[model samples]
Target: MAQTKQTRGACAFCGRQMTGNGMVKHLSACPKRKDTLGESNPKSGKEEKIYHLKIQDAWLNDFWLHLEIRSSATLKDLDSYLRSIWLECCGHLSQFSTKGHLGEEIAMDSEVSALFHPGLELTHIYDFGDSSETLIKVVGEREGTPLNEHPIYLMARNELPEVETCACGKPGAWLCMDCTESEDEVALLCEKHAKDEQHQDHNLMPIINSPRTGRCGYAGPADPPY
Candidate 1:
């Protein structure tokens, strides 16, 4: 592409004298392009230039459901567009405001903070260990098969993800049965071992002295009857 000349003009913003070539690139990243670039006639019909943005994450859609929108739109416009977001979800998220943290309020008419200003960046939600900051994970599916996989979990990206603790780092709970309860879950002795007739204590009783010791039965008192 041919570069244009800077015929003595300052950047619409920041007051930098942008060269013609620099102006092209600058417009690409500029936040004010929506307002600065447009049709001339007052109220004449114009096809608004639409730009496409990627869906950053699956979970962050709590506020932005549509993956793409027009540059001419402001963050506040999106804030107003999110009415359905509040109705679908529950909890304190039932509402939103601009005064508190971005996550505290949903896009609603009630609060100023709920409004997204122009050029506001939408970060993938994350947890930052504090009174606030809840982590939002994005599990992803295998390429080409979004339906087959889960959200790509950005674990501990913003804060340590809330993970259930395992007692031995095994599949069990953080506190094993021994730690949580003083008493063990009671169960009767193996019926087959306890009922063995040949066993000394077989009479359907727990045989502490048996060689198998209530295990699979042995010769005379094989196992009691299961």
Candidate 2:
């Protein structure tokens, strides 16, 4: 079977699909947010953004952390979730990569906080040195380091429901059943669909017209066991 081209395009920051770049751009330009650097805060303001993350650890085949969290959630919060899920074998903060990428070297203390600030939906993939099934690079640059200061570009921004109506935009009601091949190809989950409890990716069966089922899609021989 041949899967169609669902990846559409690539993201500037990472190599993933344009969706990743779009998602970041949306968070960066969210109108609901006042500058976080301001001394005062908007009491009723809320920055509503969502992101996707996959646990690429080789040994932990039982864990599937396909979750959506607010942009404000901290890495510490995720650490807590891991603790709850794997009380005995959870990879502690020290064991995990600070940059979220497979082998990105970074300081997990305060610098990562500066780079991966809140209100940004980031899709991070990790490898616990098990079998290395990961293909994406979830990298973050040092706060003042060259890698952090380098400029990355994107083709387009991801869509969000809370944003203002654009003259050239359409509803992001579509689903991206990405084939998950190159690090440049990313799986996109629509924020509106998830929040409304309307249509979900998990429920979206390949209707035979989906692009992910074509030759370029690479769905392999069996569907995921969920």
Candidate 3:
């Protein structure tokens, strides 16, 4: 079997970016956070409950993540975390609720303990106009080590999906939007091919890490230090 490459994650304390699993180990012994290590030790909190969340784009299975969060964390905190990792394209309003495709809204301030459990699922909507919906499930709960200061901790995420290649045999990283709509053929191309005379005037979009890729004005996230 082949090994899967881990997704990139930024350490909450030092802002150093590494693989998601690497970040976990990095956070465990980050010198700046050593003083708080005792509080995060799993052995010390056998009775404390943590929520294990499985989150993904509602329509795409390729983009997903496993996250562990404290039950005390508010939905707003989860919202912020999601935006930082996957959804924040603009300063658009977002919400979480039982409704899958827009329905009764739950307040952002709701606590995870109040709204989530071992089997419950919820939907999150970001940007009503060019919205992206995420399906969140409380997969399970267990006593475990907690994140130092960060409200959310990434445990795992899917590796980058393989994309089509250009006619010249290089990996495709740019999608020609105009060709995709007007021409019947796939418009994906490598950066070199994207500059070809045939596609000179076509609008090209760079492939990115978000589920909102190729969607309304969603280029990517301007990730913060955390």
TM-score of each: 0.21, 0.27, 0.74
Each candidate's lDDT (Cα)? Answer: 0.26, 0.30, 0.71
Candidate 1, 1-226: lDDT as tens digits: 0112212234443445444334444545555533433322333223333332222222221111112233344434333322122111121122222333454444323322332233343332222221111121112111121110111111111111122223223322111211222223212323342333533332232222112111222112321111
Q: Write one digit per residue (lDDT tens) for candidate 2, span 47-91.
A: 333333433223222222223333344555554443333221223
TM-score (C-alpha) between model 2 and the true structure: 0.27
C-alpha lDDT (0 to 100) for residue 19 of candidate 2:
35
Point to the candidate with the largest TM-score: 3
Candidate 1 regions off by >4 Å? 1-45, 56-66, 82-121, 124-226
- Where is the poorest 10-residue window by lDDT in model 1? 151-160
Model 1 has how many clashing residue pairs? Answer: 24
Model 1, residue 27: distance off in Å is 22
How are the candidates ranked when ordered by lDDT, highest leading?
3, 2, 1
